[model samples]
Target: MFVRIVKLSFDPTKIDNFLSNFENQKNSIRNFKGCRLLELYRDKANTNVFFTYSYWDSEQDLENYRNSDLFKGIWANTKIYFNDKPLAWSVDKVVSLL
Candidate 1:
């Protein structure tokens, strides 16, 4: 599986908006082709910072989703509330006890 992690920091006043958007779109995102799992996390000391963790069948599956209209639309709606540029990474598991 290919892991995708994205770190996002949003404008303080826009946090609620982002959360609402995520809640509404989470299902569609998780149901996207090749998406194995999806999760969201927030920094305990930094309420505005959030992270999205997901697993895809492969890098191509991730690329396909990134190229889709669904991604474009979602990104467009989501980016406007960002306090800073978002960061993302594609990683692999070296070891996982689970």
Candidate 2:
């Protein structure tokens, strides 16, 4: 499986807007082709900072999602709320306990 993690920092004033957009689009993301799982997390010390954790069947699957209009529309709306450039990583599992 391919694991994808993305860290995003949003403008404090626009946090709610970002969350709203995420809430609206998350289901589509989770159900996208080859998607296995999806989750969201927030930093304990920084409410404006968030992370997305997802599992995909393969890099190509993730790429398909990236190239989809769903992603384009969501990212276009989400980027305007960014306080910093998003950081992302895609990796294969070395080991897992669960």
How much is 88 displaced in model 1, in angstroms? 0.6
User: What TM-score number comes out for model 1?
Assistant: 0.97
Give residue 36's lDDT in candidate 1 (0 to 100).
90
Q: List clash counts for every candidate, in order.
A: 0, 0
Model 2 C-alpha lDDT per residue in residues 32-56, reported as the tens digit of each score: 9999999999999999999999999
Candidate 1 local accuracy as lDDT? 0.95
Candidate 2: regions farther than 4 A off: none
Model 1: pairs clashing at backbone N, Cα or C within 3 Å? none
- Per-residue lDDT value at 67 in model 2: 97
- Over 1-98, each residue of candidate 1 has an lDDT whose tens digit, in order, gives 97999999999999999999999999999999999999999999999999999999999999999999999989999999999999999999678796
- TM-score of each model, in listed order: 0.97, 0.96
Per-model CA lDDT versus the true structure: 0.95, 0.96
